[model samples]
Target: MDGRQDEVAGAMARLAEGDRDGAASVLRAALARAPDDPEILHGMACVARASGRADLAIGLAGRAIAILPAAHFHITLGCALHEQGHLEPARAALHVATLREPRDVRGHAALAAVLGAMGRGAEAEASLRAALALRPADAALLHGLAARLSGRGAHGEAEDLYRRVRDLCPEEGAAWANHGAVLFALNRHEEALAVLERADGLVPDVAETLNNLGLVRMALGHLPQAGVALARAARLAPEDARIAVNRATILAELGEDGVAERLLRGVLADPVAAGGAEGARAAFNLGTVLLARGDLAAGWRFFEARTRLLPEGRWPDIAPWDGVAPPRGRLLLHAEQGVGDALQFLRYLPYCLERARVVLELPPELQRLVGTTPDPDGLIASRCTVLRPGGSVPGDVVARCALLSLPHLLGMAEPPPFAPYLLPALSAGAGGGERRVGVCWAGNPAYRFDRRRSIPPEELAPLGEVAGVRFVSLQHGVAAGDPPFAMEAAASGDWLETARAIAGLDLVVTVDTAIAHLAGAMGRPVWLLNRFGGDWRWSAAFDRAERPCWGDAASRWYPSLDLFRQAGPDMPACAWRGPVAAVCAALSRWRDGRLAGD
Candidate 1:
């Protein structure tokens, strides 16, 4: 072998033994004999960078690149620059490395990383895809692309790629874990649990997989299994804000919000939980916890974090109005959630008076019913936008904020105007001596907690048998079977028709759906059936210790409403019957009171 080759081989052997000083000595000796040899210069540059002499490394790598203009020499320079946190220069060097090699995996990977560091995510994705194209069967490159896609919210395509990656690398625990996470996002909890379990067998100590397993179990209402998994994950990754938040969520759902409040507060104080997306999420979660416990100003302040949690499409760049009546600009209130949420929060829109020329936006489902909203202060003359998915927002609007954020802006400690806000034009009164009670046994199926919040229509069959009470269906969907009520065949689609029907009913019995919100706003008396893991609004209102452990029977938002919650697991599988019976018992007493008065 040549003298220079002998010295380079000796340097590599020293570096392999973790002897940086010995490696540098041998590399310098080689460079002295062949002053501009690219091989010796490349070896010297890598050794210098490893020893924390980035300036020396960069100079030697530059000399090597000038001698040969080769891929490895350029890569060595890029690594040296990256070690010094010189991202832009590193990016340039890596780009050249990729160009020189054309198909080398290391150059492409390094280029992609530098591009990502420089906030060029799309270009990084392209670079990674290029690497994958060269090594189509490579599991790591495919997995990397899948992770990037998932981060960008392209879950459907990510899921497909994750499946491919899992098949290609069955022993890779992270691949299985990520595949399970995609399944969780797609609401395929059963598949997620199965895959996560498989991952656990391969790599039992992985915190992320445990976190996902807990989440899947929680979604299925298996709280004990979820708690065990989540607690374990929290212990494993005590510094991961995501794991801590998930643990807190389990506590919150199971009516242990006090512990959740503590856990979330502790996590928020830690550096890991104090910034970035995790910080935003923790802030939003803390808002919910504090709000549930009746801390208004603090909760509302933290609730501002919701803006950060949402996608850029959902939360636009227009200056958000800070609950102040703007002196000179038109204020836009954009709907950021479902039609039901639009209905619930519409009360706040009219309050945004001559403060600004208002352009309110809401979902199409709620457009027809907007006419019925109370404008006692007299402002909503301008037509609001009926937003559809992928539709462009108007360019004329000045400041924009989400409709759900109204309560935080309004500082609403005082009770809402209890008088009817929705006095739709009266339809003909029903001809019956019996008290007509409207019933809604379901909510939109797409809602994440629909499994816990909505009851099957058939579960209300027992209530249908009540004497002197006629049950009328206010449900909207393809029923599992013929409804056990007297809903008019003509009364199924339009929100206005539904409003008119609800206005005519003597009372309404429903789950925590938008219909309940509508009926409550219209001054109709309602019995709101709540799940054990009820919503934050209901928890805030009825989570008093003075109430029965079973549940509270009153509402704060809907003054004319009564709440009935599902019994806890200790109460028998027949706990479902408790809410049904509560409504029936209340109905019977109302009938008796009417008869006695007559």
Candidate 2:
């Protein structure tokens, strides 16, 4: 090799090894020898990028490309421009680099990155797939494609690709960590935990790996272990607002609300964080903590952060309806979250019906059930039209608002009137003479925090020991397991049928699921099994006493619902033993009371 070429190669090696000063020293000498050599200029560009001088790197790379028009020089230029946030220019440079050398993986990879940064995800995936076709077993290419698929919610396909990456590059800690994340998204929590732990072992000090480890541990209800992992991650990446937000969430779960609040506020105060996803998360979490503790005014304001967190496409196209003056024509009330959220907010429909001709959009499962929602004078039936998804919105619907936004818009300091807003759809002789108690141990698994709220069927065994209470399975979607207790009423059917069954029951004992909200709305006695740091609807202080103290407006929103919170922050690692036991004791008292009356 020529001496200048050899010097350029050595400088590239130094840059790869993270010795930017050594790389610059070699590149300086090589540049002096051959002032116009594109190879030496490219080497200097690499050194500049490693030293965080994206502007200098872009200049050097441009000079190299100008001198030789090499594909590699263009790739360097594209990456430097991307680092400088010039996505359009970066995309142009990378596209040129790819056309100059279609066989080069570096050019394809760089181009894909620019495309992804430009939010052209489909085109970026196509680029990665094209590269993968050329080099099918390339670990970096496989990992990149897998990440894109995972981001787009093609988790099963992503998991398969991530598996291939693990096989091709067993020592790649990043591949392992990402594989774990896809598994977690697929709701394979145990496998995800194992994979993340393996990743942590492989890259012990990496903040990302540790953060993933913390999340998996938290999912498994191992709060103390999760805390340790997150603490290490926070120490490693103190400036990372995402990591700080995650740690604060964990602390909130552990009942360290003061510490969590401080950390979240600190994150919110950082301007860079305030402008991104992390800032929105911090705001939402702060709102949740405040609402859980009954700080209503600030809580509702910050709780609106959830609106900011929604994807741009999810927003309604029409202008928002301010709750002040009644809409001149029609008001559209839409469901933005889950069925439970819809159920919780449907109470406000009557108020809107009183003002304007209302259109309520909801999931199809809710259509039949919503018919039974409280309407003393049948105003809802007369004035409101229910729209299922894909059902037409009338062109004259002048203004729209999210259902959850009603409380804030109405300027509610406390919940309006939470008396039974839904009527039971049953006849007089529906339930048998015995005291039938419907029980649900799980919610929809697709919920992001389902692991925290759901209980294993076995955890309900203690209730079996209670005498005279007939426990019926109210759980749907999940296969009903053989519980230690006998079910007096069988489980099955659509949400309306479930509502019929719940109406016949003497009481409902349920985890924090839609059923709990349904029964509460029906004014059935509801024993809500709440996890540590439960949903904002159940005030955090609910766990303090033998029976829930309904001092907070959040809790007061469900008058018929009684909470059985996990005993302490330490619980749930014990797998709902405390709450289940409390439910058993409460059920025994209820049964005895009923028998005495009979």
Candidate 3:
């Protein structure tokens, strides 16, 4: 090679070896000797990009591409443009690179990232596949592909890719974190925790790994441990809005609303972090906490931030239609979150129907249940639409909204006062002179915060001791066990059957689970048992006191239920005892009143 070409190659070698400063110095000296050389200009651009000077990088790359329109020059220019948020230009540059050198994995990968950022999942996936085809064993490419797959809800494929990445790059903290995230998505909490812990150990100072560790711990119901991990992560990466948001979520789970609110507000105040989806998340969560505390006006305002909070690709971009008049076209109400969330938020269908023709896209499991909802027009079931596939809906719908956001739109100032609104399939037989009470002691094990929210059957023994109240098991799955109460497992059928059984009972009592939501929806008197830090749905506006007695708590979208919270982390058992006894006393009083009338 010529002397100049040899000098360029040496500089590139230094860049590859992590000597970014040395690479920049050498490239600068070479650029002085050959100022307009494409290779030298591209090399200098790369070093500038690595140093976080996107403007300088873009200038250097543009000059290089002008000097010689080569694939590497285009690729370097694209990288700089992508960093500057010029996605379209970046994509165009990457396309040019790929056309010039179709086998270039970096060019394909850059295109994939830009496409993914633009919310074009299918195109991104295709680009990612093309990149992987070129460099099949590249760990970074595999990680990117796995993330895109996970985003598309292709957990099986994503998990396999994550496993391969973990196996191949055992020392890569990011690969371990990604693997743990997939495991967590699949509801493998124990395994997820172990993987996340390993990742944390591998990179002890990494804030993201520590934040993930906190998330897994929260899922496993280890509130204190999760709090500790989150706190450490927040301290280490104070500027990382995601870590702050995560820490706030854990605090909310622990029922420390004051502290959680403060941290979340801090995140919101930082414009740099707040401008992105993470900022929107801080806003959305802040609204949830505010609403839980019964601050109606502020809660709704923050809740509206969901439109901006969601990361691209999770949901479609649909304009928010004001409920003033019927929409000019059909509106799609897509389900977000879980079955219980769909059921709880279905109350908003009436409000939406009042405003426009509505097409309700719900989980198939809840199709029959949602069908029972009394909607005069425009409620359609989403059948065979690939939530697991990167499928897109027909673009004809005028507007779209997430199902969970319905409650906020309906202006749920307090729990809705409607009871027995959701009727179950079971029949209510005459109580044999005893107050029949239904109970669910657990929640979905897959919930990230289930450990802190769900109570074990054994932990419910104290409630079983309530006199004159016949407790029935409303819980399902392996989590249910006969615990010395008048209990029957929900019959096999649909949720309608479960709803019917709950309907027949005089009252339903449950921990933070779907059954509690079912009972409340059915308008059956429900006394909901809550963890001290309870979900954002239960706390009051002032004093952080637990809200029990339907009307006593703030009015909301679902209002037939009362909340009783365990006092603190160390005294969860003791905290619940008083509330259980109070419920027993209330039932006794009702019984006595009936007898007196007779």
- Tell me the whole-model lDDT of each prediction, alpha carbons only: 0.77, 0.82, 0.75
The digit string of per-residue lDDT tens for model 3 on 1-598 reads 2887888888889989989988888888887888888889888888888889989989999998898999988998998899999999999999999999999988999999999888889999999999999888888888889988898899889999999999999998888988988888887888999999998888786787888888888777677888999999999998888999999998987778889899999988898888888889999999989887778778877987876755335444776555444436667777767677777777666666665666567666665665555433433232212132234555655777777666566665654445444654556453566677778877776565676677656566666666767777777766775453546555555677677777668877777788877777777777777776666666655222444343234224355676665656644445456556555555566545542123
RMSD of each: 5.4, 5.0, 8.3
536, model 2: CA deviation in Å? Answer: 1.8
Candidate 1, 508-541: lDDT as tens digits = 8888888888887887888788777667777655
- The candidate with the higher TM-score, 1 or 2, is 2
lDDT tens readout by residue for model 2, 1-598: 3888888888888778888898899889878878899989888888888898999999999999888999889999999999999999999998998899999988888889889988999999989998998899998899899989989999999999998998787897887888888888888888999998888888788898888888888887888889999999999999999899999999988888899999999999999898899999999999988877778777877888898898425435877877765636678788888888999888777776766788888888888888787777889879898887687888878888888887777777566666787785774455888988888888887876688888877677778788787778887775356454677555466678888888899988888889988888888878888887667778654223333422112246676777776766663548588778767766776777732123
TM-score of 2: 0.81
Stretches of candidate 2 above 4 Å error?
1-107, 110-119, 311-315, 352-357, 377-383, 427-429, 465-467, 481-491, 540-555, 571-573, 594-598
Q: What's the C-alpha lDDT at position 433 in model 1?
A: 72
Top lDDT model: 2
Better of 1 and 3 by lDDT: 1
TM-scores of the models, in the order given: 0.78, 0.81, 0.64
Residue 65 CA displacement from its true place in model 1, Å: 2.9
